[model samples]
Target: MDAHTVTRIGSHDKDLQELFCDYVPQVFRRADFRRWRAWGQWSDDYHAYALMEAGRVVANTSVMRMRLVLEGREVTGYQLGAVGCLPSHRGRGLARVAMNAALDACGDAPVLLFANPTVRQFYPRFGFQPQRQTLFTTTYDSVPEGPPALTLNLDDEEVRAGLVALSSEGLPSTERFGARGYATVASWPVANGFARPLRQLGSEAWVFAGVEGETLYLDDVFAREPFDLRAWIPRLIDRPIRAIRFGFTPERYWPGAVEAGEDTEADLFVRNLQLSPEAHRFPIMAHT
Candidate 1:
């Protein structure tokens, strides 16, 4: 076998699709190529590295640009996700090569990611430290009281579009849409194989829910006035749901004024290549 050649590439090209198909089976049990394409479409902060053997892609990883706001200030950082290597290429340091290239390209920005529990120890080798632990919160009885007067449809394209638009406004940091600035939250379900659910409350606001089995995952729950848990809680009450799991920030709104426990901390980590005086001054979540 010839030595693998690793190269940095743009996410907007066909090579990305080839990389996805080559390693989808090893990366996700249920990979949605359409959603992945959507992700690339909405992502503004994407840096991808591919490992090729004999001109065929065998491993891939990406560092998406993200924005984080803290103390009324915005900062630029990188969120590491979509890291994978083909099974045939594993244990050959292909991941390390791809990651090093990514880090080199990142310059001085702080890097962060939610590592799978299995690979927790692996990231530390690259100087990633565990900064926080997150939680998945759900409520069966928290639904607001109503007679189901409002129509609930999870498959409406308009609803999804609304949710996507709201995400950019409400949660700017996590929004991944438009060009190479950030990836829009709207593309999650289509990319991740999760079903999107829409809840409309008289045009006041809309919430998009992604369902995986009995668990309903809320991705970019957009609503004005802090969202009334009572109104939407009832939406899931009668359903055969085991629970509702929200990503990252659940404390923002979940009915009954539930506080996001300390367990839900965003684990901040860093991998420095060329640290500068202003590197530490850059807001951690600005570009996340």
Candidate 2:
């Protein structure tokens, strides 16, 4: 630790922010941090704590300010992501140092993160308890008769502007444990092509979804007002999806016997807060 310098750079810090962005892709091959930063939606609330060896980043942890809806109440929290160290820097406790700095900055606020399966044992050392998340799933019979939802390309300035406007409304897709700021964290996935934005013709609602095989993963929805999602699901999808999985709780909008399953992608860990798996699941797009 003595040979390295610990620095925290916010989104507003251009030079240091660029340094962090340049270092991230080396660790996360799919991360387009440079493009996300240039998209102009990078919130100052997102901060990166990095261990710099001379002028290059050796290890890093990012803390993103999140507005979470917990059990129907809106609250503030911190989400940690982009947490890793270069291979040369491993086994030196640099990652631990960066995590400590990030947690310290959060103070008493609830902190959460989605960690890779390989590092499942590391977070508990810092009081982060492994938590379960509910994945709501349901089966559909057939594709309804209507125009398929249009996939809004993020590259278009008009589509980007529309998403920003919808997100500024600041509505949580679900009242039971979801995210408030839609475009804040969601833009990363859209910009990186990890997820696509879709909308039905003559509708104001927009959906962020991912597809695999015959299943559609409905990550999040941005609409000015609440509507019956169960009915809208058919119109929202283009191809015939045999199953639909929701990232957020669906009890409010879609009130049917949707199977509640466990998340298999990444493990969720949190500190200073109790997030119940059966009660609510964090919005998928809100993940950093």
Candidate 3:
């Protein structure tokens, strides 16, 4: 391993980093690579660790810093992702070294990430533990007049940015648990699933979501004040939305809404469980 040198990288000439993706096709496929590259919302504090061997990238890991509100108090956290290592470089301890560097930089800040079943045991070495998050769904027997709102196009950058900024007022937002999509628009639907932007008129708040079959899924929601959850199902879509589902847990409850069931996010692990139940839905567009 002494022959290798690890370096921290930022958003510069992304071309050079393509080698990392190419080396780990199974980790970051063609589409996933493109999604992260073109993702609109990127933190200036983005951090990626690269292992250089013979002047070539041999291993890598990316750390994303996010602001979260835990139990009504603001705190900083890290979302570690994009763990990759070259197949030819196996047994060289590249991944362990790279992850150590990432965690070291993170200090005592809490971290969140999802892992596949095969690699599930790998993360426990870092003190990550699986936790159950709660998400809610319910049927709307009749259409009720929702909040005053209008839909926005994905390209509505200025208005969308402003709305997102306004929406991030509260901390500890999570998908399927009131997790807002302020981290990145990609989080709106996660995996490039269907998504639509909606603005709660009077409050100037926003939400992005999509529907399939009879269920309407709220990918992300934002508001300066507590948003009327009932407004989400009725006002946003025209079809007969029989069921409304969301990752967010609102301050107030809707009349007919009830806790339908719970979903287990396999491989989703966290270190230091200060806050909880941010209904952590698997991000459709989030590659990590």
Candidate 4:
């Protein structure tokens, strides 16, 4: 422990970023952090506080500074992520050291994080209270179908550029609780199962979604201008879906959607903000 030191690194530090990325998969098996960084999606908003030994990251907690919409009002906030210590470093309080440094860097901004079950008890020690999110869902009904949505690959330079522009101007899916300026962070979902991207309304709108069984999971949507989501949803459906589950609050888009129950997001914790149950959900794709 005497040889350990904490270091703060941002996305601009290629060497340190690589070290963090290499350590990430050891904790988060499916996070393609390196690939995401290579795509140039790691923005300056993200920073990592790492406990280093001999210049190698042994424990880390990353933060993403963001503009969050809380109960329809905009506020500055931070989302903590990628928090873990190497197997050998666990139980030595190294993770706590990294987390404390990250939280201090947040500088009083409301902070939130998703924790794994294993660390559910750890966050509460840092003034974080568990917060439950609402799951919005609605029964699917048959509608007049249009041509299927065209799949746009993010790998395509033109498509990526278009998305970036739209993301900068797009309205939050829900004013209750969501994020602004989140284009780069969204690449995580694009790499995960929600790989399909669809653009409509002359490419002014885009949707990221995937299907499982009789359900269509709408991961995220971006549009330069507010549009009729209910009316345009029928056009986006290519297969049968008896129900739709939204990854973001649906009050602004689909007024008829009902609160199903607690969202799948477990072990969620927040500090310096009151997030009442069923009020709204932090947009899924916006999770750091």
Write one digit per residue (lDDT tens) for candidate 2, span 219-246: 7888877766666666666667788788
**Local lDDT at 203 for model 3:** 52
lDDT of 1 by residue, 194-280 (tens): 545455655656555545566666644455355564456555443456567654344345433233353423344455422322112
Candidate with better TM-score, 1 vs 3: 3
The C-alpha lDDT values of all candidates are: 0.53, 0.78, 0.59, 0.79
What's model 1's TM-score? Answer: 0.69
Supply the TM-score for candidate 4: 0.93
Error of 3 at 46 (Å): 1.8
Instruction: State which candidate has the highest TM-score.
Output: 4
Can you tell me which runs of candidate 2 are displaced by over 4 Å?
1-4, 200-203, 277-279
Q: Please give the lDDT score for candidate 4.
A: 0.79
* Winner on lDDT (2 vs 3): 2
lDDT by residue for model 4 over 1-288, one digit each (tens)?
353578888867999998888788787778758667767887888989988786678899999988888777888999999898989778898988888999999888899998777778899999999887888899986443887667787767677677777777778778877887787777766755445555555568888766677777787788878778776666666667788888888887788889898865556799997764456777777887
lDDT of 2: 0.78
Clashes of each: 26, 0, 18, 0
lDDT of 3: 0.59
